[model samples]
Target: MNIIETSQLTKYYGKNRGIINVNLKITEGEVFGFIGPNGAGKSTTIRTLLNFIHPTSGIAKIFGMDCTKESESIKKEIGYLPAEINYYDDMTVSDLLEYSSKFYEGDFDARTKELCNIFEVEKNKKIEELSSGNKKKTALVQALLHRPKLLILDEPTNGLDPLMQQKFFEVLKNENKNGTTIFFSSHILSEVQKMCSKVAIIREGKILKIETIDNLRASNYKKVTVEFDSAEMADEYKAEGMTSKKTRGSQAYFLYRGPVEKLVASLYRVKIKNLNIQEPELEEIFMHYYAKEEE
Candidate 1:
């Protein structure tokens, strides 16, 4: 089943566009990546999905329920970690977590304790006294306390140290193993590449591409760097499917997305001093989409 689905999902802020005709289908137990930089409508889409803000047009559904009309019910089975966390400053971490637990059914005390322990949250410390990283740890504990069916995380590793970040992803992997669908939103391509099986790349409020990580990598996009015998040779060399081309003196770098033999045939004509061809990283692939959009 599609754990999350959106159909032509759109949002606007007065006259400004937030997301336009954004569609997504995430099946149960999938670790889906929603990738985009800041101001790329990642947060707006998340807020819309949570019904924290109503969509200007289209529809969003979670677990087959309307996001707007059935948000209360939908939220019950979802855990959310917003990009920015805000809690009652005067309350202790323990107190805040206790208050949050009152909204959900069942005994979550044991779960809360376990999460706090795992995240190293200081229960007695006031929220105001916590550092940014500690605050994030507290939020992590709160979000995972109930062990919801779906996890919606937005820039979840922002303030975490390297050790904590490792721990965080490990925890997420375990959650996915237990059949909890994860919606990981971030601008960090490496993080998405590490955790997600499939990813949707968004820019300027539109989804540019959606594909499995393996398929994306296997899309025949190659990062080719060629060093010619002279600057003139570097400048004159060109081939089909070459894009985002740049040349400096005797070196030329470009992304090629065509048959390797064709690229080899093209290169055979040039006085190539050295050549390097490798699969483009997710970041590079992401930039290729942005470049296309801009063009």
Candidate 2:
């Protein structure tokens, strides 16, 4: 089942573009990654879906319910973590969590306690006294307390330490295993690469690509570096898929996306000293898409 669907969903903030012609269909029990650079409209899309903001045109639905009309009902099944979190500063962590639980109908006390323990959050500390990391942990605890069917996370790991980040991902994985759908939005490509099965890359308020992690990795681009006996030998070499070529004395390095055999044959024409070839990182692959879009 598609737990979330949007078609040509456009949003504009005054004269500035937020997102245009955006479409996504995320299935149940999947961890979908929404990735982009800063100011790429990742937050805009999430806010629109949650009905925190209105769309200019098109449709958005969660569990087949209209986003604007049924948001209250839809929210009952969603656990959301915004990019930035704010709360009453004077309240103790225990008091804040207790207050948050009153909005939901479930008995989340046990789960809340478990989450606080896992995150190492001090219950007695006032919100004003907690560190940024602790505040984030408190926010995460609230979001997961209800055990909602869907999780909408925007830059969720911003204040987390590396160890905490790993632990959080482990928790998310367990939630997915239990059939909770997750929409993970972040600029951190490596984390998305590690956590998501499928990813949507957005830029300048538009989605440029939606691809599986495996297919994205198999996108043919190869990082190739070759060392020659002389700059003269390096200057004479050229082959298909060689782009952004650079030379540093006796070394020539470039990105390739064509047949390896052809690249090898071209190397035979040069007096080679050493050679290295490896897969391009997700960042490089993302830039390739942006380059293609610019073209």
Candidate 3:
């Protein structure tokens, strides 16, 4: 089932384009990644879906219900963790959590306790007193406490330390195992690469591509670094897929995406001190997409 779907979903802020003719379909029980740098319409798209803002022209649906018209009913099944959170400053963590729980139907005490324990959130601390990391932790706990069917997270790990980030991911994995569909949005490629099965790349208010993580990783790009005994030898070797080239002294660095045998055969002529060939990271692969668009 498609948990979420959008068709020609466009949003505008006066003359500024937020998202133009954007389309997306996310299946139930899948971890979907929405990735782009800041000011790339990721947040705008999300906000429109949540009915926090209206789309200028287009249709968005959650569970097959119109987003704008059925948002009140839709929100009951969603747990959202915005990129920035602002709880009542004077309230303790526990108090804020308890207040949030009242809107939902079931008891959240046990789940809240479990989440707090996992995140090590200090429930006694006032919202104003907690550090950024701790505030993030609180927000995460609140989102998961409802045990909602879908989780919409925007830059969810912004302030977490490494250990806490790991713990949070583990929690997400567990939730996915239990059939919670997650919509994870962030510019951090590594984290998305680690957790999501499929990802959609968006830039400049447009979605460039959507593919499974494995397919994306296997999509032809290779990171190659070559070192030469002489600068002349390094300069002589070239291939069709070679791009983003860089030269420093006697070493050359670039990306290659064609047959490895052809590259090796070409490299045989060069007097090289060392050679390294490996798959490029998601960030590099992402840049390749943008580069293609610019051309």
Candidate 4:
């Protein structure tokens, strides 16, 4: 089942474009990644899906209900953590959480306590007195407290330290294990690579590509680095399908997407000191997409 779907979903802010012809279908129980740099419309797409903002054109549905028409009903099943959080300043963390809980019907005390303990949120502190990280923790706890079936997280780990980030990821993994559908949006490639099975890359308010992580890594792209015996050898060597190539002193680095034998044959004639070849990271693959767009 598609837990979330959008068709030609476009949004504009006055004369500026927000997202154009954006289409997505996220399946149930999948950790779907929405990735793009700032101003690429990641947030706009998310806000549209949540019906926090109305789309100028196109359709968006969550769990088979119209986003704009059925937003209040849909929101009951969604736990959202926005990139920027706003809470009543004078309210204590516990008080704010309690207030949030009232919107839904359930006994969330156990879940709320579990999330607070995991994130180390200070429940007694007023929203105004908490550090940025602490405030983020409190927001996280509030988001997860209701045990909603869908989690829409935008830059969810922004204020967390390394340890807390790891804890957060672990919690997300557990949530996914329990069949929660997660829509994770961020510019951080590494975290997306870690948590998502499939990702959609958006640029300039348009989706450039959507592919599974394994398929993307297995797309025959390899990160190759060679240390030649001399700078002349490094400068002179070139292989088929080499891109983003660079040479520094006696070392050359590039991405190769052709036959490995062809690359090895090209290297055989060169006096190479050392050679390293590995699968390209998600960031490298992501940059390749943008570079292609520019070209």
Top candidate by TM-score = 3
Local error of candidate 2 at residue 254 (angstroms): 2.8
- Cα deviation at 253, candidate 2, in Å, is 3.8
lDDT of each: 0.91, 0.90, 0.91, 0.90
Per-residue lDDT of candidate 3, residues 216-287 (tens digit) = 766657889999898877776678788888888889999888789988888887677899997666566667
- For model 3, the run of ten residues with the poorest summed lDDT: 278-287
How many pairs collide in each candidate, listed in order?
0, 0, 0, 0
Q: Can you tell me which runs of candidate 3 are displaced by over 4 Å?
A: 220-233, 236-244, 258-287, 290-295
Candidate 4: global Cα-lDDT?
0.90
Off by over 4 Å in 2: 220-243, 250-252, 256-284, 293-295
For residues 1-295, write the lDDT of model 1, one tens digit per residue: 9999999999989999999999999999999999987888999999999998999999999999999999999999999998888989989999999998888998999999888888888999999999999999999988888889999999999999999999999999999999999999998877888999999998889999898988765664888999999999889888989988999999999989878999999899878889999866655666777677689
**Per-residue alpha-carbon lDDT of model 2 for 41-117, expressed as tens digits?**
99999999999999999999999999999999999989998788898988999999999888889788899999998
For model 2, name the residue pairs that clash: none
TM-score of each: 0.82, 0.85, 0.87, 0.85
The collision pairs in model 4 are none
Candidate 4, residue 285: how far the Cα is off, in Å: 3.9
